[model samples]
Target: MSFDYDLFVIGGGSGGVRAARISAGYGAKVALAEESRMGGTCVIRGCVPKKLMVFASAAPAEAAQARGFGWEDATAGNFSWDAFKVRLDAELNRLEAAYTKGLEVAGVNIFHQRAHIVGPHEVELADGMRVSAKHILIAAGGRPYLPGIPGDDLGMISDDLFLLDRLPGRVLVVGGGFIACEFSTILNGLGVDTTLVYRGDKVLRGFDNDLRELLTMQLADSGIHVRLKQNPARLDKQGDQTRVTFEDGKVEDFDAVIFATGRAPYTKGLGLENAGVTLAPNGAVAVDEWSQTNIPSIFAVGDVTDRVNLTPVAIREGHAFADTIFGNKPHNLDHGLVASAVYTRPHEVASIGMTEDEAIQRGGVEIYDTRFRPMKSLFAGSDARVMMKLIVDEATRKVLGCQIFGPEAGELIQLVAIPITMGATKEDFDLTVAVHPTLAEELVTMRQPSRRHEAPAPA
Candidate 1:
């Protein structure tokens, strides 16, 4: 069928950009439309900027650690939000420019306007222009969801936190998810009085219970007021600050209230129905493993499809889709077994494969878990302890899951994911030589299962 391009990608996010670039590389004419920024959520708001803030916010703790290491002159003074924001904005601009350059170099036409499906193979931009394509890819990412409460607009989401002109003296962070935990840590580290309120019993509700409990303690130890089982009923703007009324009928005032409750798929008003596309109950675009929507001519990837919502996963899905459709390589990403990390204060949480609970529920599994204060943190006079857990299948001796909570945990889990994803066994891990004096060595040296559960008998 004759069309405007071989592939028309809506939303210039990491996923969309990758699909567009790869499809163009395969000699398919491509065009991409982005209503906002070219780099999408990761580069512009979510990961890149958040990580930068994580680094910036850690200055105080790092300075204290330096002092503990005998650098008496090291001091953690007041953080200058204005100064950091200037540099941050510049870096984002550079990244946005790079995204634009890459798309241009890849021969993908770029449209700096909103777009939606008007037909199976047609897209209508905000300017009333309609373009048709042989195939369409939707990579429009997710949007941060705010609680449907009074004066919710006055509360800031994660994106708004990054754009703040100045850090508040006292801040109230909402939700039990990683976003709420991480930002509470960031604000506390930046010398703000931070209080975290989550309706759940603990933060990071879906992670391993051991990690969750320890992390909650670690967060409290780091000086964040952890208010569990509590949620803000409403937010009211009181002069320059915000007054939050809790469900318990308690009231508190804060310089700002930030909502990190959760994010929803960014498929709103895309007119998917016009294209006969299907959407999940949660509003995510319904797609197959190959990212193909109900309409054969249309496909969706990234958070829009709500599979694995991580940036790397989205990129993989996008690449897989482009390869399958344009490069004669029919393949799809294995949505399962992808590794993830949460950047929280005092420590990081990383995991791959099943949790202990999942392993217990599935077949049967043995668990090897250890906790100790690492040498580096020990020398720095920090009380934070490191934990490493291995969930193994006793029958096959294969490691079912690995979770690490400590220094360089993110890096450690990345490497651990390699072996776990390769179907490495507990014996295989034990066979490897331990890196002396390293916390990760525990992965190889644990000879005993702290607990074991045999598989349930067949009915």
Candidate 2:
């Protein structure tokens, strides 16, 4: 049976756009609908804009460090969020336009409206237009989740950070995850009196414990107040300020309260149930390795599937889905061993592979680690430490994980991910010659295990 289109994709995000474009490239007629901006969260709200802020936030500290290298000071007392916001908004507009243009160039019909699954092979747009296709793809991404507390709406989400007209004099940031830590680091660097309150004992809960411990210290050292085992019980707007009352009965006032708490799949009101698509309890669309849903005519990818939730991962998933279904080159995007980075200035972090906890659970593990004041920081008379760690399988001598928490950690980890993904052994890392007088050389130069755990004799 002929249809209006070959594929109907409900999101215009990184995944949806790539899928729609590639499917059309393979001569499949495609239509895509996006209720919001074409670039979705990454280009519009999450990574792109946030990373720019990370760069902007680093200026003050880097300038101070330069003076220590015998350069004269031409210091600015404060960062101008107003001036930066104008440029940031313009850049985002250019990106959104680029994404839309690319989709058009690829021959995908674009719909600037909301869409939801109405049938196994049909989608209904916000304008009440029902379109039928041979297959449907849901690439709708996730939304920032705000915990329900009294007057929580008075607080802001990470998306709101990019839109702020001015940076707050002081801000209270909530949550313990990467998003939380990242913004906290940015705000602190930007000279906002930033306080980070996490309900857990340490920040970055799922990362290697060494990273968690070092990052927590780094945040505190960089002048961000790290408050653990605490949570905001309520938030109240007091004129231009927010008065936060914590679970422990501590009250604090700040010009703003930002919640980088977490995000939930943006599947609400998408009418997935109408298509008989399975959904996880948190509302993420359930799909197989090939991204197909229970109903073969429908599929989901990207953050909507709640798998790996990174922009690169989403793009690969989209490419894999289109190639498998349309181009006849069947392959699944491997979710394992994907590298990620937190662009926190002065102490950025990048990591790949298992945490120490996971490695220990698998079998015997060996951990090699180092922490020291880097040459630059030492030259500047700052005692800030950089931490690098390797988690290795004791029995096989294979590197299980590589984590670095310091300057350029993100860039270094990207290169390290290549070797680790190729199943590089600890011996390989040890045998490699160290690059002289560089922070990254520590990764290759560590001679002995800091600790080792033998498999518990099969329990």
The Cα error of candidate 2 at residue 19, in Å, is: 1.2
Considering summed lDDT, which 10 consecutive residues are worst modelled in model 1? 356-365
Q: Tens digit of lDDT per residue, candidate 1, span 263-342?
A: 99998899999988999999999998889988999999999998888999989998998899999999999978989888
Model 2: lDDT to the true structure: 0.90
For model 2, how does the per-residue alpha-carbon lDDT over 40-125 read when each residue is reduced to its tens digit? 99999989998998898888888888888877774656677788889999999999999999999999999999998898888899
TM match of model 1 to true structure = 0.98
List CA RMSD, all candidates: 1.0, 1.4
lDDT of 1 at 235: 87
- What's the number of clashes in each of the models? 0, 0
Show where candidate 2 strays beyond 4 Å: none
C-alpha TM-scores of all predictions: 0.98, 0.97
Q: Which candidate has the highest lDDT of all?
A: 1
**What value of lDDT does candidate 1 attain over all alpha carbons?**
0.91
